[model samples]
Target: MRTAVVFPGLMVCVALLAGCTATAPSRVRVDQAEGGLPNCKTFAWIPTPQQPATLTEQRVKTEVLAKLKEKGYSEAEKADCRVTYVLDVHERPKNKPSVGVGAGGGSGGIGGGIGVSLPIGKRNEQAGTFTIDIVDAAKNAQVWSGSLDATFAKAELNEDEAREIVAKVLERYPDRAPN
Candidate 1:
């Protein structure tokens, strides 16, 4: 009897934790080592019209800047390397949890649940893909290119989450800087 009531609560906690531990962005496979990306840490942000419904061009810029700065990248019009990133987002899975009423409020049948509509199972998988390309002013071609995928709670509410995701995407640079 007691176990019956505690089991569901325990399960719900597990589901929420799983959602947060989903995935981190990825690194682009590039050739070369040493003398690739400069240590100046100069990066910029560029948004596309086809981006996710979660943010506006202005907000994305703000978020990206914050993320980069948080990672120790300074804001400058010019630096050793030119970094520009484009954001693309697509909607994947959106799961709504159908919670049946368990044993609650004296409504004793199977049980009762809360009125919240949050999904208990899988959620709508929203992805934020960033295309970061570094251009060498001396050479007209792109020197480095990287992409990152981030899953968000909702497609429309992306501003807050973008900071964390974009920062993570750029975090790869510290390790991937050409061998």
Candidate 2:
């Protein structure tokens, strides 16, 4: 009975430790004009001329559009509001050096141990910032913006992940009533 409990407890501890290695916490920030978002029911996506559209861009746009629609907003050729999004990724070296130490001892007779410490190669990390800006079409000025920053181990971005990130960021958007 004691063995069974001990084995299960050890497995639980190991599982908990494994889960602790998940991705780092992400940061989100939102800023809106004093009067809050416009009462417009329609909006359009405006692409930046400087940066050409990419796969990730297209995926995020689609996800955001769906989310907006779910909130009673529609897409129109010429609408009361314009939406533009930006995704920026930067690579930086993790200044912290990796160190490893190991020791082994002989089992029988006189036991002796040897230890070694070595510095491992530097690891590269990728950080990304996703921002969405909502502007008043007639005024040509931004009314609200939301951004999310996160550090990731993988350099490549996937559609599903982008969709999830965009959804989380857009959660800050104020809901609009049917118009």
Candidate 3:
């Protein structure tokens, strides 16, 4: 009896841990114009309409800036390309446990057992997508884009962790700015 109860609890714990262990982003995608990208050595931030300034946004911008610099792009008032990002975060339903109650009787005696179905997969957690776009400032057309989907363990992300995620998404970008 103890083993049955303990085993279910242990399985629950393992499932929760498995969900928490998903730190890397998935569904990464990148798109660029057919003619490749325009020669852009400098970039400027283009405000995303309706996006309020927030800590998460700030962290993303900071990390993106650093990554762009590393890739030979600099921010300036007059730039060859414009940069912007969109973040979409929404709650995702986790696999929930189910409980079933039933009654049974046998000719020898009456017997019953309660059964519970426990979720052994993703627990209730938040998932989100981060997308970055680079547009030609003069032509007002997008040149390149990168995006990643991730399951966030927490509602809020610290700077360091956010940096790592941003870096991963940016990995799809060119190694250096287009000349």
Alpha-carbon TM-score of each model against the true structure: 0.47, 0.68, 0.67
Candidate 3 wrong stretches, greater than 4 Å: 1-27, 48-52, 96-116, 119-123, 177-179
Question: Lowest summed-lDDT stretch of 10 residues in model 3?
Answer: 1-10
How many clashing residue pairs appear in each of the predictions shown?
14, 0, 0
In candidate 3 the C-alpha lDDT for residue 179 amounts to 45
The lDDT, on a scale of 0 to 1, for candidate 2 is: 0.75
Per TM-score, what order, best first?
2, 3, 1
> What is the RMSD of candidate 2?
7.6
Tens digits of per-residue lDDT, candidate 3, 1-179, equal: 12222345555665675577565637669999988898888888996668677788788889999999998888998999999988787888677666554444455454445677887866678878888999999999998998988767766767876898889888888866354
Compared with the true structure, what per-residue lDDT tens digits does model 1 show for residues 54-107? 344556567656665666666666554565666676876567544433334233
Clashing pairs in 2: none
Best to worst by lDDT, what's the order?
3, 2, 1
Q: Tell me how far the alpha carbon of residue 25 in candidate 2 is from the true structure, in angstroms, after superposition.
A: 3.5
lDDT of every predicted structure (CA atoms): 0.57, 0.75, 0.79
In lDDT terms, how accurate is model 1?
A: 0.57
